[model samples]
Every structure is written in C-alpha cells, then in structure tokens.
Target chain A: MNTNTQTTRLYHSTLSPFCRKVRLVLAEKKIEVELVEEKYWENPPDLKRRNPAGKLPVLRHRGHMLAESQAIVEYLDEVVADPALMPRQPLDRHEVRRLCAWFDDKFNSEVTQPIMNERVWKKITRSGYPDSRAVKDGLRAIKEHIDYLTTLLEARRWLAGNAISLADFTAAAHFSCLDYISDVDWDRSEAVRDWYATIKSRPAFRSVLADQVPGIHPAPHYAELDFG
Target chain B: MNTNTQTTRLYHSTLSPFCRKVRLVLAEKKIEVELVEEKYWENPPDLKRRNPAGKLPVLRHRGHMLAESQAIVEYLDEVVADPALMPRQPLDRHEVRRLCAWFDDKFNSEVTQPIMNERVWKKITRSGYPDSRAVKDGLRAIKEHIDYLTTLLEARRWLAGNAISLADFTAAAHFSCLDYISDVDWDRSEAVRDWYATIKSRPAFRSVLADQVPGIHPAPHYAELDFG
Candidate 1:
C-alpha cells in the first residue's frame, strides 16, 4: 500500500472552531494530519485553491480535497472505522450527525459569531470596528443555546444521548473557543457544565486549549476552568 | 418481528437542500423513513423541541433524534451498511467525506446563499432589506467554485470520483435551487453542467425537480434541463 493514502493534510488555523473539530476527530481516530495554518482572513491563493469558498478546516487526504468539518470527520471515521465515534445503529449515527451539523451551523452562527468577531476574526480581517450590539446578541444567544443543552445533558451523560460520540466533540469544539473568551456561563447547567469539564480535560482537548490568539488573552481561568 | 426498531422518521421540508439529501440517501438505500414535513421556518414548539436550533431534516429512528443533513445521511449509510457511499480504504473514505462536506458547506455558501437568501430566507425571516450586492457576490463565488469543481470533474466521473456518492447529491441539491433562480452560468463549466444533468435525472431526484417553491417561479427550462 502506498503511504500517500495515510497522509492527511489539514489546512486550518488554531483559532478556528471548525479546524478544532477536524483535529479532535483526527485525535480520536489516532490519525495524524500534517497541520498547515492558513491565514484565511488574508485570503491566501493557496488556501483559496484548496477551498474556493475560503472556509477553514479543509482536509486533503488520499489525493482528494475535503472541505467541511462534518465531511472531514466522517471520512476519518469511515477510513479508520475503529474506536468508532458514532454508534452502529443507523438511527443512532444520524443522531450524531445531526448534532455535529447543529454545532457547525446553528451554534456557530448564534454563539461563536460575536466571540470570534470581537476577539480573533476582527483582528485578522482588520474590520477594526466591533459592534457592541452583535456582541450583546451573541451573549444572549449563548444562554438560549445553553438552556437547550441543559435539557439534553439532564438525561444523558453526553451532548447526544449517552455516548461520547461526534455530537459531544462537535459541541465541545465550539464551546471550548467560547470558553476561551469566557463567553460561556460555565456555572449554568451543571450537567452540561460537568460534561464539558470532562471533555476539556481529555488529552485531545489540550491542543485546542493551547491555541492562542496573538492579540487576545484568554480569561485568566480559561486554562484552569474545568466543567462542573 | 417489531419493525419499529428498524423504522426511521425523516423530519424535513420539500424545498430544503438538506432535506433532499436525506431523501436521496433513502432512495439509494431503499430504506423507508416515514416522511415528516417539518415547518422549520414556523418555529413550531414540537420541531423546536426536537431541534432546538429549529432546522429542518431532523431524522428520528429507533427512539433517537438525528439533526443536520450531513450527519443524518451518513448515519443512514452507517446503519443501513449497503450500497456504501464511502470507499473501502481509509484514505478513499476521507476523499468521499471531504467531497460531501465540500458541496454541503462551500457550495451552500457560494451558490445556495443567494438563492436561499433571495427566495426563501428573506421571505421567511421577513428581513425585508435584500442586498443586491450579496446576491451579486454569491453569483461570483459560484463561478469560481464551479471552475474548481470542473477541474475535479475532469479526472472523475462524479464529484468524489468513480461511483455516485454524497458529494454529487449535495451538489445537485444546491444546484437545483440555483437553477430555480436561473443563477448558474452552465456554459462556464460543461463538465459540472453535464454532471448536474446526470444527477437531476436520477430516480431519487425526480421528487426534488417536481418541487415548487411557494412564491418563486423556477426557470422555464428547469424541468427539461436534463443531461441525457
């Protein structure tokens, strides 16, 4: 077997939530991806060549370019197909996929929007103007999303039912970044908080926590803050 | 034998690209999911309860809730485990996943952004101010995205190469909508245009073509825009 098939090249930024999602999946599958940090905001020609839409966390493997965190992670799970991050049931797997999408789509828009804009993206894109209205709205949106999360965590140990499936990683990926900004009211929703704490403490999560923004300082408790 | 354990429920909208993706997978699998039309825009309590984010195409199977189109479709393939949308090798699987994510994420932003924003979301959200600039930007984004896609299609019969997979379906789902708005410059990429023609003619795609958005008139030749 040609070793080229084993090569996983991920074009991502440490501050990008989507990149972290792919990273966690790689860590889970014990697959090594050569991480290339792309300055997405500056719009590199190489990055645009990899992903025309200019989104972060594009995975190039097996001589193919994979864009979208969901597809990248699922591809990882499929190729590895061991230590499965998803349940075997068709329905159960769907459940995991659904939550992964939720994190990337809805949660990112509502929760991560302001934090990234106010903290990293604004600086990178050099927008220079921070909309206090957007920041306030994002904080409020986080609370609502958290309340919904509370209901889910109330009955299950993980974000998507009982297992440490893709859903948990997806949720944690987004939340970890918000936690960095201290945007997460970790005190609310003890079950969810505890669940996050456990995920944060995982070996896979250490790299995500280690991610730093040049102009942004994580909350003093950011590193030490554990869930629950 | 209790059939409920094997049965599936698809909560979706007839007009949604994400929902149509699930429909394509179901058609491919020949596994039936009781179709549940979800009014994602209405924000019905039940739908919101099932999907706190209030998105469409939530799949419920064997007492589990699956949200997000990418996750739901993969979950379906996983549980069904026949007519695999993924390749046998790990690297090849990554290729498929990457392609799927590409169409769903990048294509959504580039192509579907304008059509959905102009035709559906604007009407639903009642955010009356529609920026022609954004619509123009969306159009421009796709031309570039299509060139990249055309390059990929040059070497492969389908989006992910070789066999029909999630990538093609995801692309078709978005393109079909763009076609509705007469937005795609099909002449720009003969390969992509022909590939789309091939997809829209699939047995599973019949329903999608037949669908009519409430207040929008699809291109006159849309139904007849066939590859064959």
Candidate 2:
C-alpha cells in the first residue's frame, strides 16, 4: 500500500454530477484535495485496475482509494465529523438517503443523464449530434422534479429536513450540472430558485461554480451568486 | 398519521431484487413484517402519495414510511444492532457500502435488470415475449461479475469482508432473483458457487428462498441448501 496518507486526490470529471457531489462534500468538510480530471469513457486501463467498478469520482485519501459518490461522501462524513452531513436519528438519516437516491437514480435517469448525454457529452466526445426528442423528454421530466422539490422545501428548510444534509448537496450537484448548460428554467418555482441561490452562494459551492468545461461554455448566469 | 407503529409492513414486489434485499435484512434482524405485493407498473395511485419517489420496497417501520432499498437496509442495521451488518470502522463501512452499490447499481443494470425485464417481467406483465438478445447480453455480463466475486472471496470470507455484511445480502438478493430463472452458470467459478451456497443456507434467506412470484416457476435447484 502507498504510504502517502498526507495528500488527498480526487479523480473526477468537471460536469459529472456524481463527481460534483463528492467535491461539494469534501469542500464542505474543509478537506483539501488535488483534483485530477479523468476521461472515464475512454476506459482507462488503470481505472479498472484501481477500482473494480471502473467509475469516476474516485478519491485517493489517506492512502485509501475510494469509489462510489454516496459511499465516499458517507465515509467522509464518518471520518470527518465537524460539519455532519448526516443526521443522528436513523429515521432522519433514512430521509437524507432517500432524497439522495431520488436525485441520483430517479432524477438522473429522468433528467440529468438524458439531457447531458444529448446536450453536453455528445459535443465533448464528438460522438454524435443532439437528439431533440431525448432532450425534450428530459426537459419535460425536470419540471416534475422541480415541483416535487418545491413541495419538500415548502415543508422543511432543506431538501431532506431542516438542517442542510448530503441530500441538499446531492440535489444541488445535479442541478448545478444542468444549470451550467442553462437547462433549468428557474422561473417555474420560486422556492427551488431561492434554494439554489442560497446554496450557490455558499463557500463550499465556490469550486463547483467556477468550473469551466473545455468544449462546453457555461451559461452566463452559471456562476452568479445572486442569479435570482 | 399512521398510528400503526406496532405493525411493520413492507410494500414490495416478489421478484424485485431491491425488495428481496430489504426482506433479507429485516429477517436477519428478526423484524416481523407483513409483505404486501405491489404491482408498481400499473401506476398504483397510492404509491406516489405514500412515497414520493413511487418505488419499492417501502417499509413502514416505527410509524415512519421509508423508501429506497439502501436507505431502508442501513436504517434497519442502525435501529436493530443485533447481528451487526455494517462494520464499525469508517474504511470498513466504506467497503460494505461500495460493494452494496456494486451489486445494486452495476450488477443490476448489467445483469439482473436486463435479464429480468426480458425473461420474467415481460412474461408477468404480458408486455411482450422474451428478447433473446438482451438475455444473452445479461448472461454474458454475469460471468465477469462472478469472476470478480471469485477474486474477492479468494482473499476474504465474504463479498465485502470476513463478517457477512449488507454486501452479501445485497449480492445474494440479485443472484437469487437470477438463480430463480436458472440463469447462473454454477460451473463458472467454484468460489462464487460455494459463497452463494453458504449465504443461501442462512435462516434469514429462508423467506427469500420460499418466494413464489405468480406465473413464474422457479428453477429446480433455486432453494436447495446443498445444491453443490
């Protein structure tokens, strides 16, 4: 095993929501990390050797190689407990995890994955032209997600509960990716817009807001703290 | 609103891997639960209202409605400490969670979901006939996964580590579903076959081994404890 436990490094892609989620959590906990952009789609041989799953957002921290965004974030929360991203109660923790899944699995399949695959990835990878139908469907599905977030925000201060948890950062991670492309129509729900604005202005969100993907230019308001 | 905190009820589908994972965990913890089969594809109106994500398995435990399989299982482990399913250390816990994601996300997408959607779901829902191409691809994918499991089992007692964890149950849940259909090539790797046999004989696995999805007959050797 490598004995260089002092340095922390993250293998990530700029616009990938999963990567951004890890970056956000790491930043929130005030951990310094060296970011290395990985072109995972090219199927880097070393990636598979290092991580069996061969997925991104792989963190090399304290001599351990960690993969999976949720697992990494939860691990970070456990090891570095200063600003707890998870709640104490099991039931409350369940809520935080449920919403994380909501954004990562459900919302991702419905919105982010489809839209990004068409709008951003295709252009970056030179795979093909955008599929209008897929983009339209993703755009259509996002409205439902935004409305659902409105309902949650109406009842509580944050996405999962009153205290900001990994759920909020998870949701923001996906939204920021879309927002970078100007896909989110912030006008649909003022509550969600305000929530995004508040989260956007945070110190933790600075690195993410400043992201500049080479081929894809971020929207004019992408980095604005007070876009609303 | 639910005064029935005394009764633990799970809304699930018999053949779903996610539902089986929850069932295995609940049984391991000895939590008595009433399983209600949900035909989620029919777009059960109440599923949406009860759980915002509208997915299974949704567990009503201690008066709180819980959704997301990983969230529910982790919650169960947290609330009921007997026969601990997660390791205490942060790194070990990360390994468990990462392996759980391996089976649930990667294995499900590559092997279980495609095979089940083609072979089992299409037959149950009467949507269409089995697509041999999809089934073939899933079958091809399972070999690589089984090989990876073999590599892990060679060094450790269980999938994630020595102690049987949520990783084992999570893996068994998916494998059991596919095994029900006689899809697994038992001869592929002796290590994996032995590992499955060991996990299969556990008392907690009885409920899952006894599951009978309507209109789908299980493979002849599915529930046999000493199949090897």
Candidate 3:
C-alpha cells in the first residue's frame, strides 16, 4: 500500500462502470491519483475495513475514506473547481445527477450488469459459461438506450445540456466499460456514435481507453480516436 | 391528471423506498407536494413519456420533469433552504451521500428488494406466493445491517453526523418500507431502534407513516411513535 497521504489513491476494478465514472471525473479534473485495482469480488478482509459497505471505487483523499462513486465524484467536483463537472444552476445540476443515476441504475440493470455478468465475469471468475440469453437481452436493450441518447444529443451538445458536465462523463464511463468487450452496437445511431466519439477523444478518456483487463482484449476500434 | 403546474406534483408509488426518500426530503423541507400514485410496474404509456427510463418517483416541479430519487431529493434540498438536508462542508456532504447510497443501493439489494419482492410485490402484483428462502436470506441480512447502523449511531446523533441530514432520511426510507411489513427486527439493536425511533417521530416521516398500499396492511406498530 502506498502511504502517501498527500496524494489521492483510488481502489477500483477495471471494467466496473461505477469505478470508471469516478476515474473519469478524477482524470477530467486533472487530479492525479494512484490507482490500485482491487478484486472486491474475492471478499478481501481489508475491503470491508476500507469501506464498511465493502464496495469498490473507494477513494482515500486527505486522509478521508470516501465510498460511493457518485458521492466521491460530486465531492471531487465540489472541492476542485478548475473544470467543474456539475453545472451552476440547481436545475442543471439535477439534470446531470438524473442522467448519472439513469446510467448507474437503470442502464446498469438492463445493459451493463447483465452483459458484463454473462460475457466478462463468467470468463474472469470462471463461474460458468456465458449465458447467451442474458447476453442477447442486454444487447437488445442497448438499442433503445442508444436511441434515447441519440434523441438527447440531437437537442444538446452533451447528455444533460449544451455544456460538457458530469452527465457526459457518467454516460461515457458506462459506455467505455461496455466497449471494452465490444458489446456496444456503435453503428446503430450516428448521433450517439458522434457523441461517444467526441467524449472519447478527450485527454481524460485516455486512461480509460488504455485499460486492458488481463485476458480480455478490447475491440479493434476501442482505442481509435477517429473510429467513425 | 392534475394539470396544475403551479403545485409541485410527484408521480410515485406508495411503498417504494426511492419514492419514500423523495417524499421524506420534500416533507422535511416543508414543501407541500401533491402526490399521485403511479402503477409503474404495469408500465403506463405516460410513464415512459414522463420519464424515458420508465421509473417511478418522477417529480414535476416548475414545469420540469425530474427522475432519480437521490437527484430529485438533492435538488429539493438545494432549491429550498429551510432545514437543509445536506451539510455545508464538502466532506460532511460526502458522508451524507455515502450513507444515502449505502441504504438505497446496498441495503435495498440485500434487505428491502428481496424481502419486499417475496412478501409484498408478489402479493400486490399477484405474481406468485412469497419465496421462503429469499425472504429468509433478506431477514438474515437485516441483522448485520442493523448492527452496522448501531455502530454508526454510537458515534453520532444521526447516521452521517451529529445533525439530521439526507442520510437519516435515506436510511429511514428503506427502514420504513421494511417496517410496513414488519420485516425489520428492531429488537436486534437498541441503538438502531433508538435512531429509528428518533427519526420516525419527526414530522417529515408522517407522510410515510400514512402510506397505505391497496391490499397489504402495515404492521400494527408501524405508525406508533412509542413502539419501543
């Protein structure tokens, strides 16, 4: 364990969308963090000690242990204002948060969790063979989600509104995870593809695009800036 | 079908913890909201139109549709200043959010969802009879959660800190739902029971106490202030 109290440290998993959201915000805000990949599924004894809830994406900053990705990202935005992830107006901030929850909760249930469970976790944990039915359901659900994003992007520059905010990063975080195993049907919507392409090209997204999960390989176009 | 946009209207379900959390915060802020019970499980056509994600607890305030319980509650707190639900300090606010997620995510998954699904939802939706194994597992999980809350209350007056915050309401939301069906073993932890008693006695909790789902009955001691 790195005992540098001055610097921030994050314990997270590679493909977990929740952890990726925090990492995106950290990188976006230009906050240099020491990333420690934690295999929380194995039930490490110290994991519960770090976070009583025993969840991942735990951040240790200024000697305070912060759990919950949404909460941690919001804290980072509050403390560091260089590139604000949240908007100034309460309504706009609410929109940002609503979309964040949409991805973290609804999208996760319908798409990320199911897809990852079948495709990624089954392979990594050696739990069982990938359930084709679950994977198909997740794939089918993604089309509707992509269409929804396309509708949102048609009216605004970002997920929440015109300005780039936490909503964009939050959506991108989930998309990046799904993209890792080539689950996303990028060809379905031009608007969504454009939106992802713009967000993916950002310097903050570099760390996420460069991620390689031990045996799993990223899609051919996962790292490309001009994939479209 | 209330067309009055002047009055804040919340389309929600009676027993959902997410909806209850929003209702609690709104009541805490002294915000009089018109509640319209939505049958979200049936996926009403307007539900998808109101919230693209097709979830309940959609708050229409100032002609803007707001989804996501946590985000909606946070917005209400920000917009209304009296009896602030969030602390002023960044770290303190983070603690509040962390606990909110702890209940909404962890507690919901472990205790509320399974127990409610088996005991309440099955009955309400007329799907099937309660699954004993699932209910037993959920009941078993609650003891550990109550113990954890007992430990938290030992240090502070409230869940997150000395003063009442969103964390308290978020926790009470889940507990209130479980309490409705008598799923919570309040006798397991005196500290947790005391904490619940204190929060449950507040005016904000009245709306939750008055909650009546169609066929399912609330526990006899559910509404009593002196249950302990």
Task: Choose the strongest candidate by DockQ.
Answer: 2
* Cα-based lDDT for every prediction: 0.77, 0.94, 0.92
- TM-scores, all candidates, are 0.86, 0.98, 0.98
lDDT of 1 by residue, B56-134 (tens): 8777776777677777777777777788876676666666777677777667766686667876678756878677888
Window of ten residues with lowest summed lDDT in model 1 chain A: A1-10
List ranges where model 2 is wrong by over 4 Å. Answer: A1-5, B1-5
For lDDT, candidate 2 versus 3, the one ahead is 2
CAPRI quality band, candidate 3 = high
Listed for each candidate, the true contacts retained, as a fraction, are 0.92, 0.95, 0.89
Q: What is the lDDT of residue B222 in candidate 2?
A: 92
lDDT (Cα) of model 2 = 0.94
TM-scores of chain A, one for each prediction? 0.91, 0.97, 0.98
DockQ of each: 0.58, 0.93, 0.92
- lDDT score for residue B69 of model 1: 79
Model 1 misplaced regions, further than 4 Å: A1-10, A27-36, A50-53, A58-67, A78-83, A225-228, B1-10, B31-39, B60-65, B120-130, B225-228
| Model with the higher DockQ, candidate 2 or 3 | 2
Compared to the true structure, candidate 1 yields what TM-score?
Answer: 0.86
Clashing pairs in 2: none
Q: How far is candidate 2 from the true structure (C-alpha RMSD, Å)?
A: 1.9
Ranking by DockQ: 2, 3, 1
